[model samples]
Target: MAFINGPVPEALDREVAATPAEFERDLRKAWPQGVRSDASLSLELNDGALRLTILLEPLEPRRIGLLTLPRLCARYRFEGGDERARTALLTRLDRAMQRGGG
Candidate 1:
């Protein structure tokens, strides 16, 4: 896992559970087109840091009549640092989620 040295905003921690759609939307935006698959998002908080992971599993071209397991496509970690830095990082993360990180 990679560590980003910065402060994690309290608001983000609160939103983690309150706004799950935000995370799902971001994952869908990051998902590749023309790929028949399903995705899952995982969030973890530890020691004032947040980790977001996107896992994708193909749905088509089934083998042995079983869907393939999801694979990690993206993993992001935000750490808590100074208030100013934390705010900046949180803003970036919010925008990235809205824009699908493209």
Candidate 2:
């Protein structure tokens, strides 16, 4: 796994378990509409905060069911970074992680 350098916010860590919807709301605002899909979405607590992970289905119609490719998965930490900035960062990171073998 590719590692990112930084500290996760403790408040987020404490709040994630019970505040999943709020966390997702923040994540959705940070994510891009084009990349968002009708796929599995989950929250994970790691280090000291809430992480968002997505399991993406194949975007290609032909390859979706026939080809058993890996799911486009990504993990993100919602630290106290700027909401706007982190949203863009999350989108880029998601794409990168998806292409970089999770």
Per-model TM-score versus the true fold: 0.29, 0.25
Q: Relative to the unseen true structure, what is the C-alpha lDDT of residue 73 in candidate 1, on a scale of 0 to 100? A: 29
At residue 19, candidate 2 shows an lDDT of: 30
By TM-score, how accurate is candidate 2?
Answer: 0.25
Colliding residue pairs in candidate 1: 6-79, 6-80, 6-81, 7-80, 7-81, 8-80
Q: Rate the local accuracy (lDDT) of all candidates.
A: 0.39, 0.37
Q: Cα deviation in Å at residue 16, candidate 2?
A: 22
Query: Candidate 2 on 32-93: residue-level lDDT in tens?
Result: 34233342555432222323334322232233567643322233445544555445454454
**Highest lDDT: which candidate?**
1
Off-target runs (Cα >4 Å) in candidate 1 are 1-79, 99-102
lDDT of 1: 0.39
